[model samples]
Target: MTPTVISPASPVELLHYMITYQRYPTTLLICSSDDEFRAAIAEELKGQIPEEQLQQEPDEFGEVIIDHPLAALPIFRRVVARHLRVLFVPSVIHLRAILSVFSQADSPIPPPPEEDSENTKQGARPRPPSLFAYGFLELHRDSSEWSAQGLSSSASMFVAAARRSGFNPVMVEPKAAGGLANFEHVLREHAPILSGGARRDEGWQGRTVEVRRVFDRWFRFQTGQWDIKWPEDNAS
Candidate 1:
């Protein structure tokens, strides 16, 4: 399944998302490459999000579905372990998404699970939502949308993880603006999460960032509330 990706208006727009929606410390920044784009993004996010919170891409960039199952990948395992929301920022990175029934993608691999027959019965693992979760999946795309993250590749696993986290993600993008120019002057400004006046998209004209929740009504992971209303906002 394709990962739900978002190409925001600017880097400031992305920072605004983190400040407004992802106020908690449950988010994780997973860089896909150490190239200029990733480096620029990491550099820009310094004062806004802690350095430790970010996880740069490892050497195993394009070697997914190579040595181990997608479930066994370190990043995937970490997402399962920490219940952390993932922001898979990447540039020129691709991974093997699906393995055909006969194609030799991974050798000595076990047979894919077959559809159970009418009488065949097997034990199935229980799927339950996390008791304590406050995170969601978000991808801040640069100019080229779906170019970084594997759009039609291995992304279903991530969606499953988010569902277990007890909430859904609302992807924000540059609806009217042309596209993001670069990753500079990110986290330049921040508004209190609780405070709101004009909508964030109303007057953001330049380097200054006035971040707030992109949507007036959305699912809040921290409180498990969907209709989160700000007094100053939606008063009219």
Candidate 2:
């Protein structure tokens, strides 16, 4: 529930979630160690999003990125802090870096890691933001075989780590030919956690208690014996 979903159509779904789900200005963060795939994804995004919306500023939704593995996590931390909403599609290596924050058994929103010398400006103790940006991370399966016996072919050591760690990525599968529309519907189903307005305090007393439920869910994630939630236990 770290505001990231895992699916095959991640880049497409990330854009769909950002633009179609809400009007708040957001950033599309591309995390890659090289420009090998960034350019192609950028071109594809251009076709779906208007030219004006791609401007990288607070006034408008925009596309931003980190092409360095070392700088990816620190920069992403800053981006999510600055922008109210951010939909990031990160390379696998970069994804792990972004997710490492959750593994630390310390503060929920701890300051940037010590290794990030560039984050010296982020004060000694930064207060956690009330709300967070949501997005997707693409799951890629290399042809490598599982070292553990009897595990499914899809379950590699890395995949198992993802399942147990604080990465806590929600697994989503695209329906056959369901297209972006189907994914949007599914996102609507998961909106309690994914929506930017999820943390809004106004009119909470009148709502059907979704806000309270959200708080309990987060509390469970922080205090539970296992930080990860089984996909089948909560949802199909």
Candidate 3:
């Protein structure tokens, strides 16, 4: 029988989506050596979506999967400039698109190695749409005693960990440009809950974060409500 997992919070929901979508837009899984934890995550995911959609990869990256339908979705890729190493910017979707584009390359793309604690400090980078759209999936041990306070505290830590994982971790607030702030605010507000400790920081501090909001029009277009209107982004 397929395992069933329950997620009482939105963070879990986001993780389910991220894990499920891995098979689609791009099939890449990032997991640790813990099988039980991975199984728990997969079970929790079964609660969110159907079992047929998930496929696992048995290799160094561990049991990973991508949604079959999203196989046709185009991906984007961006290089992490050494100067912007610690910044968590851009949405995960945007990163996914970027990575998908880069995955086309025949070479094996490498993830950033674990950062040395002594050389780290707070930093900022441009936020992309994917990160905002997907939010983040922070895994924590069930044995760890976590309260509401811990969830809030861990948000920052998860972002930091994402940076170490080679993704931008932008500090989004309730208000910011490109609807970036709004998207993150909504995601976190609607984010699924999970076990964790206190957050490392309260919020972010940055003046110039190139953020863009995905307006209702984009959704409308996505849903076939109207034709798609893409902005002329020279940066890409």
Top candidate by TM-score: 2
Measured on C-alpha atoms, candidate 1 has an lDDT of: 0.30
Q: RMSD in angstroms, candidate 3?
A: 17.0
lDDT of 2: 0.33
Candidate 3, 112-179: lDDT as tens digits: 35333323645633222122222222222122323233334444343343343444322222122213
How would you encode candidate 1's per-residue C-alpha lDDT over 1-236 as one tens digit per residue?
12223433333334334434442223433334324333443334454554455344445564212221222324233333333344444432322121112122222322224422412556663222211111111232222222212322223333444444532333333222223242121111222222222234653222322222222122221211222467866885
Off by over 4 Å in 1: 1-7, 28-150, 170-236
Q: lDDT, candidate 2, residue 199?
A: 29
Worst 10 residues of 1 by lDDT: 129-138
Q: Rank the candidates by TM-score, best first.
A: 2, 1, 3
**C-alpha TM-scores of all predictions:** 0.27, 0.29, 0.23
For candidate 1, report its TM-score: 0.27
Superposed by TM-score, candidate 3 places the C-alpha of residue 52 at a distance from the truth, in angstroms, of 15
